[model samples]
Target: MSSTELQDRNVAWFTERPDDSQLSADARHLLESYSRIPADDVVEHVIKVRNQAWTIFPYPCIGQFRFLDMSMKYTKEYPELLERLAKGQRLLDMACCFGQEIRQLVADGAPPENIFGCDLREEYVELGYQLFRDHDRLKSRFLTADIFDESSPLVKLQGTFDVVYTGSFFHLFDYANQVKVSTAVAKLLRPEKGSMILGRQIGAVNAATHDHKTNPTGKMYRHNPGSFQEMWKKIGEDLGVSFSVDATLHELARDHFRFHTDDTRRIHFVIRRE
Candidate 1:
């Protein structure tokens, strides 16, 4: 579809999205408890901010409200993860579109000052403050810079985070660019034993590059668990650092996607700096 047509379709999708009451139990609790928003107003607020975000970038994740789905809660490592964050280690949320994960971290008792979020668009970062209603209360910094741009302001954040969280990212790029992005992420992480890169993404059963309408080059790499591990192995070699990749791939259920398809799976991963 044409760019304008794609935008129109995305707008409709966001406008007609489901109510927040339909969100998963954990997600609903997080919104109600942390955001201090009444259950009656949750859906309206989510829809309003999400519609604004959709206009900025019409991503399927934004339209489908995937940000509300907490991948961290699903992981077995959540307790340890929260402990690390609560201990005052730095955490960065890469490509943090609306800072939903950052807010969730705060709600889980992680120090707000230790959390940071970065995104390419300033609008998304600004909207995050409004969405969580924590402009004054939350101290975490939200920066705006392109992750792929080596000379961008993100360079100042190099080697600063104890953990970096990336969700629904990486698959957006072709293999070569994926390596570049991974390298950048590695640079942002602490080069210590326990530091890690964690999150989830869409993956293919048979890992390979796939055509995406949003990509001008028309290709993006999708990984199965093995391919993802291999990619990180190569990244580790290239960076002169060792990493242990722990990942799992599971069938895509109806709740994970707006449309059901057998070709995709959810890949949850943790890459530790060793």
Candidate 2:
């Protein structure tokens, strides 16, 4: 699709929202935890913030309220992960649109000082402070910089994080740009054995680059478990760092906007520095 067509589609999607009754369990929990109170007011607040964010970037996660579903919360390793974070292990939420995951981390008792969020758009980062209503209380830092720009301020974060979480991020680019992103993430992670990257994104049963309206080149790579593993293997080889990728593909919920076709699944991945 052309750039104009993509923009029009985004505009259309921006106006869509789930009804108040449709709010996910996680969304409700977060609203109460953050004192967004009087259930009715919380629902309105979520709709307004989400609609505004959709205008900025019409990501499916934003459109479907998936941002409230913290990826780490569902992981089998959550107990251990929370323990480590509370003990001061550093975490970076890459391309963290609105820093939802970071806020969830704070809600779960992770030390705010040890959490960080980075995204290319400063607007999104700024909005996060408002959405979570924690600008003053939350100690986590939010950086604005392009991940693909080697000289961008993001480079200052190299080798700084113990865990990097990237949700609905990597699949936005083609294979080449995905490698660039993975390489950048690899650099940001600690060299210690346990440092890793984890998140979920749209994946395909048969991995391949497909036409995507968001890309200038009109293409984005979708991966299955094996292909995702291989992509990380190649990144490790190029960086001369040992790493292992464990990925799983699961059927997306029927209500998910991305579940338009049977070929699409949600890919959950963990790339560990070995």
Candidate 3:
């Protein structure tokens, strides 16, 4: 079959909702956006990232449940921080994929006015803004900005935030860029015990460095959790602040490849300076 045919097939499969009850308006819109994209732009390589599941299954988002499930599992590691966020603490959700975690923060009681988010993809950020329009308590705003762009809007957001948070974006940069981002994140802090979250693929025996080739478009840089830890350790040393791995959120990433076992991947982190 042609790419268009394959695209149509995938669209047909994804159109079948898991359940009307499981569907949110934003979720529906996401699915619709997926359908609207041309088959030529829908690269086969992306399917490989999730182990062909997006092509084989009817799911709207990859690892949707697993991401939240892991977050709940590692609750203890971030209790103090999460609790503080729950109590109207200001937050900046950098490179927030779909803003679900931001929603969770609002649900946990973070003030809406205090939450700010940005993404390189405008559609994702736009979706987030529309999704949270009804909630006055979660007046979270989303903007379009490339984190790597030195003059991006994010770099000029007037003033620093109370807590600058980034979950999955760290692993998408090389070690040097990660360090740059760490400094940028630090600068975004209000100079009052600021903290950020770095979640990356980690292993005991392996040192996670930059993995720049996994993405098909050659636009993303990735790292394992260990690399993130090391980056922060160096940053902490330079900044004269103590830093440590707050928790290792394991079984958090799922790869359906037959060669990998259940203990394979994780979304672990280092929480410091708060």
Error of 2 at 250 (Å): 0.9
lDDT at residue 18 of model 1 (Cα atoms): 61
Clashes, model 1: 0
What tens digits encode model 2's per-residue C-alpha lDDT throughout 133-228? 877888898888888787987788788889999998888899998888888888998879989899888898999888776553456789999999
- Candidate 3: global Cα-lDDT? 0.51
Error of 2 at 76 (Å): 1.0
Q: What's the residue-level lDDT of 122 in candidate 1?
A: 95
Every model's TM-score:
0.91, 0.92, 0.62
Between candidates 1 and 3, the TM-score winner: 1
lDDT of each: 0.80, 0.79, 0.51
Candidate 1 residue-wise lDDT, 136-206, digit = tens: 88889888888877788779888878889899788778888888888888999876787899988888788
Residue 19 displacement in candidate 2 (angstroms): 4.7
